[model samples]
Target: MSEIIGFAGMSHSPFATLLPPARDGEPGGRFLADSTKVGAAVTELRPDAVVVIGPDHFHANFYDQMPPFVLGVEEATGFGDFGSTAGPVPVASGLGWAIRDGLAESGFDVSLSYALTVDHGVVQSYEMATGGAGIPLVPLVLNTAAPPLPSLARCVALGEALGQAIRHAPDPGRVLVVASGGLSHWLPSNDPRDPSVVGERRSSLIHGRQDARAFAAVREPRVRAMAGNPDAPVNADWDRWFLRQLYTRDLGPIVELGHDKLEEEAGSGGHEIRTWLVGHAAAGLPLVWDSYEPVPEWITGMAIGATFPVPA
Candidate 1:
């Protein structure tokens, strides 16, 4: 039976890679150091395959045809996120299919993509944790960007299913599981085109396509600013609270936290924690190491941690 030899989490911010922290041991600086450590851990374990549980930005899914979850079934490449490093990566096709089938059988309505181009959320983990070697990868994409998001309980279920799938794999190899995305940070979330918005705008759009285009034109600048600002807002208090709850690993309160609560407290970007939840559940052990720092420069609540199995 296959085994999850290692599990880890890390920030996937493009600024974490493209820009250095203003000072030594700052958020970005620590991110680099910890990422190197994760990469070293990967080298040490030498897992036969790596499964990355991560989310996509607006790049992969837009307002139209958003999928809650997707599994990449083909050899995937990175989009070189925000000028960060990227390249083609190998795919563990057999294992990917196994997990896909397993998830479907287990009641997960996951979308499958034969030709998917992963962005920084998935790529940064490989670049930082594996030194971008030819280790085959399976990308499990989450819909953290769009609204009516999946529940935290659902995320935990997915993680449990993932662990079971890995365990039942035909080839028993030391597999590395990396959950990439958040601690806490807010970005541009509101858009006129959002499905949640309704009434007058919906009526206007129904009347004329040009009116809809005009509405988007008005709303685009704020969203663009949210993405472009290097020193976007960071909620350190919320980040700390989240880390405390995650440390418990019960996932009860977390499961109940809807997107509004997350946005109100942890910020919209905090939704990325869904990725971390997957890894936490799969690790099947109390975390051994964890760290958090609010890095406004990277515009994120930069965090990293890992879980090691207890000794027999």
Candidate 2:
């Protein structure tokens, strides 16, 4: 059986790639330094494979056919949005297939993608956590952006199932789980199904897969615009509260908060916490170290956290 050696949850933003390297004493800079520390810890574990649980920002999966969860079974590629690297990720295909089967047995009818193309959401966390090391990984994409989304409880359940799958897999190697995205911030996303979301924006959300880069390009300006807005909100209090729940391994408040309430307090982008919940529950380990900073310049409350490694 494979062992979950470690777990990490970190906030990701394109600003980490788009803007100049953050200077010391700046929120962004502090986040970068803390992320490096978390990455180094992950590398120290030297796991056989890493499982990245993150959300897709309409780069690959779209409303054309968005599943609640997707497992990259064969190939995974990065789109390189926000100046990040674009290329194939070293996917652990055998273990990915095992996880898919395991998920199915556990009542999770997750979709499988042989050619999954992810954006900064997954890649940024992967890069930050492993420092771009050539660690084979399985990318698990969740639908956090789109509306009519899965419940937070369901995300927790999925994580529990995922952890079980990883533990019971035939491979007896070490596997690390990384969750990417969110503390508190907002994005200019609207439900494509909504009547107000007309014109090209709506079209892009529904059928953007044909030209993923073009859609990304179109959306880039909105994200960049947020960086310039001085009034962009980053709820530090909410971020700290969420981190407290994770540190204490108490998810009842998070689940009770629900999607609507989270959006109300943490902003729309806070939906990405679903990824963190999944990763936390999947690891089933204690969080040993963490750091947080409300980086309004990046339009996201930046945070980094990791779990204690299991005994080898």
Candidate 3:
């Protein structure tokens, strides 16, 4: 009966773009969502262990394979990127074993080839969320940037499985579900006319309205953009639908974070970070930065969130 203490989500690229530039260990790197402010309670709650969910650029950057199919990359393969935490991550074998067995049985390709490197999306955000308190984590990677990546439906299924895995975890203490990456964003040096990043931009849209008219004619295009076409707009439907099924119980957005010009704060890429925590014995969590409200349809997204624990 272990309750999932906190269920959270954010854009994976936020840490990569925001953490490095953060001033004095603050979440100053990104403008759209600030980890320091948003995840303050997670650290304070002091859960026994965390399950960090993130994307593996290898899957997203390339196009050979789609997701729901996980690869245990050869230890020697390098992402050529400097911000990876791929070295000797203390992975929970029980969790890995479960993920492996489950993926294999589900007809998803699961590989345990070489060593896996940790990306900044995990380490940096973890650092901010927990203030480097050194919490043990069972890291799961999403092939967000790779080819043959997992679909939105599959990822949500993975999340449900993750909840089960963590619940089954023998170790005691509360467990937190942390999903990181993506709010609408545009990069620097990006041509407004170029079709390499995102398609036409829309504002003031929240994640609650499921009415056909809410998305009107914009749903499908948004999803394709999210599929990383670079020439399309991100369809919030797939991700939102998955989250709605997995957590919200068909409820609408609980928290929203979005910034118009993330580049202005951290250069290229906007930011969004939202949270969901469910726990019976949970203590009140603190807000890291002063609570902020976004200007209606403004370019910048204010960081807002919710934190509650789920007890066993």
Top model by TM-score, which number? 2
lDDT of candidates 1 onward, in order: 0.74, 0.87, 0.40
Q: After superposing candidate 1 on the true structure, give the runs of residues whose Cα lies further than 4 Å from its correct spot.
A: 22-27, 190-231, 309-312
Per-residue CA lDDT of model 3 for 130-169, tens digit only, reads 6556666655555443123333344434444545655554
TM-score of each prediction: 0.84, 0.96, 0.52
Off by over 4 Å in 3: 1-3, 12-34, 59-61, 64-87, 99-114, 146-149, 186-247, 251-306, 309-312
TM-score of 3: 0.52
lDDT of 3 at 84: 39
Q: Tell me the deviation in Å of residue 251 in model 1.
A: 1.5
Residue 251, model 1: lDDT of: 66
Per residue, candidate 1 scores C-alpha lDDT tens digits across 236-312 of 88776666666666867777776678777777788899998887787665567666777777778888777753221
- Return the top candidate by lDDT: 2
Model 2, residue 111: displacement in angstroms?
0.5
Q: Candidate 1, overall lDDT?
A: 0.74
For residue 67, model 1's alpha carbon misses the true position, in angstroms, by: 0.6
Candidate 1 or 3, higher TM-score?
1
Error of 3 at 240 (Å): 12
* RMSD over all Cα atoms, model 1: 5.2
